[model samples]
Target: MASNNRQNSKMTDDGANVTSTPSHDTRQASSSIHVNNLSYDATEEQLYSSFCVCGDIKSVRIITDRLTGNSRGFAFVEFKNTTAVSDAIKLDGMRINGRPVKITVAQPRNSINDNRVVQNREEYQRNTPSRTRVVHCKKSQYDVYIGRPEYWGNPFVIGKDGDRSDVIRKYRAWIMKKPEMLERAKTELRGKVLACWCKPEACHGDVLAEIADND
Candidate 1:
């Protein structure tokens, strides 16, 4: 992942230029942090100014609506080291853009922790009624695990500029080819509802729902 594209320096209300620079290497496997409750208008520059104080940031990706390009109120920040992740956790209740952000260490897509999660999901599926529904996401009810598309952005699908079909194909293949990776996703959506912007038109969410709801 590339570092944030915004300029790392910002001017405070007192006309002070505050620059936060990353002093580390490229990235670590588990060095990413998940941030929620972000103000809708917050930008990459704002996030860099807030987090660059800890260490080097590899990237900042705020989830957004593919069609409207509006903030989905959540983002991922990858630091250059584990230490920075720990420091970021302390900022869990710190205000940014007028809202207290919730921060946590993000688990990588493939990890030993994920294996246990898959096992738990298998158990949950066996115990519960199994079905699936698709619905539009209200701001507050977005399921961080299920509602969020695994292939929403980079490191999953390399969707070219304006190539929506390529993105869809990749997301579908991820769900179909690697069923093991989606156990938690399946458990989250099985017999439950999921939120997506498009319906009746095939989408990444439908790919997930199809794989999760069926055998």
Candidate 2:
């Protein structure tokens, strides 16, 4: 009878232990989250400090532009406790550094196929004709056409009656070879006809012609 009672007690302890494991798993899963819509000037320390109000922060990462090393305006913060994640989201759009910040749980990174689809969609939007304008090349002697964004559309024909197609092809090649030039042109022509142009669409041909003639 003594041996039987000991065996029954051991079985009861095993059942209790089994029931507690899932609760521990739930606690582990709730801790981390993703944050977004960060200010361009935000630093990791600032982010972590801001989030600490909710709970203990395990880590914080702010994504930045690779070339310029500037903030990409987003970040991810992980909490040591799951309850802190909920509190952090409640603080979403909370002001930090004089700018509103967006915070949310981080989704798992997409697979390669998903990334390819996103890239293709962005490329399609960028290449659409209505969205871009053709500009006559002013930099070269030939009748080269450049494509600019519609907002910055300022197409110009450097020489009289230049072939629009040839200009477009040349501009496309130039953009591929020297992509930085496009950004420079945008900055140079800001708040005016040239800055808003999308290359190769000639959306601002007349305005560009006047500007060139004035020059």
Best by lDDT: 1
Question: Deviation in angstroms for 157 in model 2?
Answer: 26
Q: Write the per-residue lDDT of candidate 1 for residues 15-94, one digit (tens) a residue.
A: 99998775666444578899999998999888998999989999999988542356879999988887898888988999
Q: How many residue pairs clash in each candidate?
A: 2, 27
How high is the lDDT of residue 32 in model 2? 64
> Which regions of candidate 2 deviate over 4 angstroms?
1-30, 110-215
Relative to the unseen true structure, what is the C-alpha lDDT of residue 183 in candidate 1, on a scale of 0 to 100? 59
lDDT score at residue 131, model 1, on the 0-100 scale: 70
lDDT tens digits, residue span 1-215, model 2: 23322222223644652222222222224466666677787788888788899998888888864433557788778787778888888987888787887777775454777899989978975775332223435533323232443433323343553566555445444443443544444344423333323334443443333323221
Clashes of 2: 27
